[model samples]
Target: MNIYKQIKSEILNASHIVITSHKSPDGDSVGSSLGLQRFIEKLGKSAVICHPDIAPEFLFWLDTSQILLMTDQPQEVTAAFQKTDLIFCLDYNGTDRIGPDMQALLESATCKKIMIDHHLNPQDFPNLAVSDTSASSTAQLIVELIEQSGHENLLDEHIGTPLYLGILTDTGSFRFPSVLPRTHELLAKLLAAGVKHHLVHEVLNDNNTASRLRLQGYAMSQKLVIMEDYHVSIISLSKEELEQYDYQKGDTDGLANQALSIKGMKAAIVFTERDGMMKISFRSKGEENPVNVLAAEHFDGGGHANAAGGMSKLSVADTLDKIIDLVPKYFPAQ
Candidate 1:
């Protein structure tokens, strides 16, 4: 169904629109939401972003005042769903990704739902879905929507910045295999639209706090365990360890990738105790060495082949042991 054309049509016809993403708002989630909002404004309409939770502190620089967090204001979020005529689900495929509260509101709403994402196995909830696993990010799809829907003339710095940020982060700063020539071509357009690429990199990367560095150091030096036999690295941090560093969300954002950088390491798994449960993040290199298998089958989560997320109700030590025990079965020694 001409995805670009239909989405444009829906936006033009709808009076009130609400945008949504997954619970844990990452760069892709925030960027896609903001980028699409700007695009809708360019179309002479408006949208309010309703996320299940707040974004990490690192992304607070973007203009996110329009976002209504369900964690902060559930009544307002419910009202938005009740009044909106259209909904745009970005980044994630399933309603389950937006947490139980937002999921129920989305399910009960009779609004026309449109999903634009770059993930595996999109759900059948949306009236229109644009799921392209190969697209670097959902933000990239926002740009595609603009260009393909005959709205390329509307893309400017305000719109391009967030879309560029989404592609940059989701592609691991252009290092991930998902990036292709088309991705770079879109990047060039963003740059030409005055996105100031270097400024974005500096803002995103150079804002790390000292406490974050200290926590990462402690994790890498003390908690890290390398299983040379299976070529996997594991880092598990208990709630106490996190508190010792005055931990904030996203403090361990790249810890798994750092562990995976070790020589001969096929995959890296990090477990952090937060919110009374163990949150798991998996990172790996190469398609043949997917971490999503373990994330989905064992960890109660799933995502892209190279990166995925899951959670464990088990204690940190037990969760670490469980992952170690499962490594042999899913990623046997080479």
Candidate 2:
């Protein structure tokens, strides 16, 4: 499908546009949304980037303070949605990730809906969907879209920085298995477009607060449970512990990678209890196990093979027990 043509046609004709990403906004979601917003602005169109939750502080370095943070259906956002001629959903394919109110707005809006994502198993909701799971990040896909749409010259410093940030974080600083030669090539282009690499690096790596560090120490020292026999590692953090540590969202970044540090570990799981639900994150080293498929089939979540996530309605203890009971089935001793 000619994704570039479709996107260009929609943008050229539409006046009011709303761009959104998934809940618990991550680097890729914010980066892609902000980058796309700037790109649309360059085309002489006004666009609003909205997310259901506030992003990590480090992400603010992307200069997304101007972007709208929609915790609920605000009157301004709702008004924009009502009059929007087009809506672009980035990073996530399904509206389930964008939360209920935004999902309802998109479903009910008369606007032309477009999806630009890099996740597996996309839903058939958008009028034009561009989903390539092989892409390292949705920002990378947006870069390709801009190039194909003949908007390469429109990518100024503002657009370049966020796209670079998205690509960098999503690929784990270009250390993940998804990093391709083309990914580097795109990074080089973004750099040429005046993206500040050092700023982005600092934002992603050096901005961890003291509270987050303390929380990490607690998680690693007390919460981590390693089951070498099962090649499974589990880390569970309760709301009480988080409150004690004064933890904020994104404070637990890379907490799951601590399990991968153990030798012979096949899979690592991190469970964070919040608002009565267990938020689970799964990580794997090699292709020995398919974490994303496991998350989708067994858990109510899906992502890439090496890293995926799911949430359980069960309590943290029950969720851990369920994962423990299921791990042996997937990783049995030969």
Candidate 3:
């Protein structure tokens, strides 16, 4: 059977379902999982949403209070995994991205597995997978799945809110190039369903605390370093600097994009030190510049053409040097 049919069949057959996403869940991941969970509950099945940990506070506005935040292998999630008849992995494409614990459960579970995602290069694990890289967000794909599964009439505020958050955050509030006509149509549907648009906006964009604002200022002033060629920009923040500025986990949400705004910059990189290793985020301007390829090839990460991320064992300085060396290969004229 085709992917859509397979997904519909799985939803129909599932009596007990577990929904999960990758570690350090983003808006798309959390939003997709919650949206799918609510949809499944509407079918009168028992569904549980589980993630590695609590999502960022800003995302709390999406009604994630009931989500199971598992730091380790808890009895609840383990029992759910054992008993679940169906498992839905949303947003993430790879098991490694989901971290080892959940990956193990997914690999060992007797339940049928379905992957609903929009990310490029998905892992081959699911019994049924619905992957559309063209879709703006996994939540959007879930919306399509609901429609295909004859659950459109069941969509309510609980489901629509998270779906709206997923599309909004993934498309950068519909400003990114990924936003298409269908995306807008979905947004219109979500709005008509009474999803609180202004509240989502306020929670996502307006919840920046005073400390986060100060941290952004410090990062912009002290950490942002532009190359003389103007082809690349790098921003590095140490754990010390973050503490000094009272930075929170979600404080640096858009800092990488800020580098891209600089005139003449072709590529931008953000390097942050967390738990001794360097976390790097990459962004590029045009189709010819494949930041994701660079991330996969050079830094052990992969994502879309315009955005990517990876982690390195190297210190921040070494990672920056390594990334700088790679700049000439992509932008040779510089």
Candidate 4:
């Protein structure tokens, strides 16, 4: 399939273009959208990158401050959606991933929609879809698309930096199981394209404030709970605790990973009290123990098998209790 060729043609034919991704925009979501935006701009077509929510603090250095934020500048972003001739949905499965408010605007859009995502079971909503679940991240797919589209020359530091950051972050700096041989090949190509790889890594991983570090340390020392029989470890933080530590949006980003690293641990969970809900993040060792199913069934959230997320309207304590009751049932003895 001439996938990139078709997408390039579609972009060229459109006058005004808009790009978007899921809510709580992660590295992959924000990176691929901005990378694609830069590539398209170099082709003499300017595209506005719109996101349903804000990117985490760690990703702020990506300099996407100029991008239209749906939260802060709703009218501008809404107008962009209305007037756009084409919209590229990057890193997420559907309009649902964009959240309810943005989903309404997206569904109302009469423009051609292109879905470029790496999530499983994408919804059939886009006019053109290049969904590949096996791919590590949407950033990887964007690289393949540009190369296959015969526009590899357009991938300079501007495009490569964000793309590389997405792959690095989404794959846990190439430590996750999703990092395949193809991922390395893409990294090599990106490096050759002059992406500041080490600098990007330093910026992504090392740019943490003292408060964020203290918050992480507190969560690890005071809040962790381990279930020996179920091989699960959980950490729950109340809003009071978050406020005590001056919590920010990205503060708990990798807290679940610390729990998952314990000996004999197969499942790790983090629940943070946020806006009258307990926001949950789940991670497991392998797909053999799919967490998304457990999340969807119990927590009203879902994602990849090994890395899923959910939410609970219950108070933080009750939410933690409910999860403890469930861990034994779903994650039975191996």
Question: Candidate 3 overall Cα lDDT vs. reference?
Answer: 0.83
- Superposed model 3: Cα runs more than 4 Å off: 228-230
All candidates' lDDT scores?
A: 0.93, 0.85, 0.83, 0.89
For every candidate structure, what is the RMSD over all alpha carbons to the true structure, in angstroms? 0.9, 1.5, 1.7, 1.1
lDDT of 2 at 81: 86
**Which runs of model 4 end up more than 4 angstroms from their true locations?**
none
Compose the digit string of candidate 2's lDDT tens values, residues 169-261: 888788878899989888888988898899888768888788999999988898888877878889998889899999788898788887777
Candidate 1 has which clashing residue pairs, if any? none
Worst 10 contiguous positions by lDDT, candidate 4: 92-101
Q: Which candidate would rank higher by TM-score, 1 or 3?
A: 1
Ten residues in a row with the worst lDDT in model 2?
A: 68-77
Clashing pairs in 3: none
TM-score of each: 0.99, 0.96, 0.95, 0.98
lDDT of 2 at 111: 70
Clashing pairs for predicted structure model 4, backbone only? none
What is the total number of backbone clashes in candidate 2? 0
Cα lDDT tens digits for candidate 3, 223-334: 8888857478889888888888776677888888888888988788897888678888888888877789888988889888888898888877788788778887876655
Candidate 3, residue 109: lDDT: 90
| lDDT tens readout by residue for model 4, 119-159 | 77789999999998788899999999888999898879989
Please report, as a residue range, the 10-residue window in candidate 1 with the lowest summed lDDT: 58-67
Ranking of predictions according to lDDT: 1, 4, 2, 3
Q: Looking at candidate 2, what is the lDDT of residue 318? A: 83
